[model samples]
Target: MKECPQQNLIVDYVFRELDTKTKTEFEAHLKSCQSCQQQLREFKAAAPVFQKARRIHHPKRPAQNYYKTLKENFYPSMSLAQRIHEWAADFFLTPSIAMRVAQAVAMLVVGVFLGRFLFFQEPIPVAVKNETSPILAANVSDQFLRHYLQETEMILLDVANTNPAEDRQILSSVKQLAIYRQLMQKTILCREHAEELNDDVLANLINEIELILLDLCNTEDENLIETLQNVRRQIKDSHILLEINSVESRGI
Candidate 1:
């Protein structure tokens, strides 16, 4: 069977990340996919308004409890099967092309998650016209932002926990590039919202996360393995995930 390049391109389109030729091609097919058209409409409707939300978190928002939990189970346990799979995987795939392979494998592996909605469906549900209630709009925007952050936390946990390869190891055929790209867009939305509202802590952590995510999207391989390892360490070292966890844990 032939493949649908539009699948990946659609996510890019919703985020306004596509090139002219690709965007033109996607629109040509998009005219036929009623489902996609509906999704795109919702995406456009929810965006700019959410970006304008002045207050993303309330004054008496929930406090952090996960910081203690994080300190206790800093390196949470992983299942034996997952451990074996990752370990054996390291042997078969080499360093140079790990990302390329991972990109291919990720497309298939993450389909269950992305296919169901993440990649193809419209994620933002808020309407632009209802921006009259600033608090409500901010809450809605924060909900989506939390969802994106949690997903990224899980992916980073896997990348961090997976057994390290000496030179070239981890993150190949392991997950899809489209997934990170989607997360990147979400993070951007979250970061912009965070910055505009003077939420410095959230903005800073998101900035750190964006750095790693961009690397994942670009697959920069100069010090590839080391870079990934550093990303893992940074997650813990910078305590960015912990901070995001704190915000999310308190349901902020």
Candidate 2:
């Protein structure tokens, strides 16, 4: 089947990521394209399956006390070499086929537990640490700042391309508003770090972004279009998107 260029937007549409104008355009395309319609139907059909899979309860593992007992009984009775020899002989030379298979399975399970007890250490929660720390604060790297800028750019594009006439909900969207609040808070955190760096230009740009986010979050529905237009103009005149791209490329 010939592919439609608009098919790529189907995921965004299903996820409600597309801004109003792009979503309206894609919906129009969806009406005309059989392939995209079928794909969308498939996506909808698969949603319940995924939800059910997520809710599935997995079988619980043996308790720690079970392992403790296994360790006490299995490892302390003999020397390591004697245990290995006995295990090997029991596994390979057992006259009963069922007994040999049981021994093999037990050995496999025991080895896995033994290896875990010997070498497994709890992993450091790096992502948690990064998230809790301010961007570029202390030992945190500049990657979080780059990621924040990229997300801001995407939100800005969504705001810029929104059609005021058709997408009256653009400025009032609950999801978008929530995202704006989050980004604004993150921007404030980033501003403190930016000030510490002593780079006036970087600090000023972040300040501008914070101001834009504030306006976006606080604009009244009655003045939505005017606010959107002003925002688009501000973004274009300042070339903020280009600056974001440049900063992303040249690391802080």
Candidate 3:
């Protein structure tokens, strides 16, 4: 029979399924013929996917004697030179244990520095003027009064932006805004009282209330009228907190 054509042999040769003689002949033909060489390249590219598919569909099973043969072939003896080489490699190439110790020491130093900076620093004392001092009292009252005026302006601006058609929502937002304004005014009055008594605690409380008013004025959400009302209630509650603190501070 005549020899099989080279083009058919290309696929078999690409997949390594050709006999030795046929493979030899196919490679020789591939060297001489550019078309056969190109065909071989194309077949080589397409053969891997088919090989993978065959492996997936028909996986090979291990022989029963594989582990027994493996154990029998295992070498237990080592030459002196080989042993020395292994020891030398482990000593030179393995990572140093001291590196871990150094890292831990570094972290401890950083932690101690941060703790000292955060907790042990002394708070500077605030200077307090005499009770019933007119100048200092006037300054504290003016500070909180400015805060109250700013809060009132913000509330008025918010109300101006509300739609009159949505009367319920507008009224709710306006009522909450009014309550916050009243709280802000009360905070200003409290500042005057604090300045008259020369009480640091009351001054701090007034300052905190002004901050709360600023926060409420800055809050923006047409849908959060209820949440805003809660904030207003919180500001009202601050007054009660101030009263309780004032009574406690007087030793009564």
User: Candidate 3 lDDT, tens digit per residue, 75-171?
Assistant: 5467899999988776556636886566678889999999998889653321121122223334445455445444544553444344434544545
Give the number of the best model, judged by lDDT: 2
Least lDDT summed over 10 consecutive residues: which range in candidate 2?
132-141
Per-model lDDT: 0.69, 0.79, 0.59
Error of 1 at 224 (Å): 3.5
TM-score of each: 0.40, 0.44, 0.25
Per-model root-mean-square deviation over C-alphas? 40.4, 29.9, 15.1
Arranged by TM-score, best first: 2, 1, 3
Name every residue pair that clashes in candidate 1: 102-172, 102-173, 106-175
Determine which window of 10 residues in candidate 1 has minimal summed lDDT: 125-134
Best by TM-score: 2
* Order of the predicted models by lDDT, top scorer first: 2, 1, 3
TM-score (C-alpha) between model 3 and the true structure? 0.25
Model 3 stretches with alpha carbons more than 4 Å out: 5-138, 142-147, 155-226, 229-252
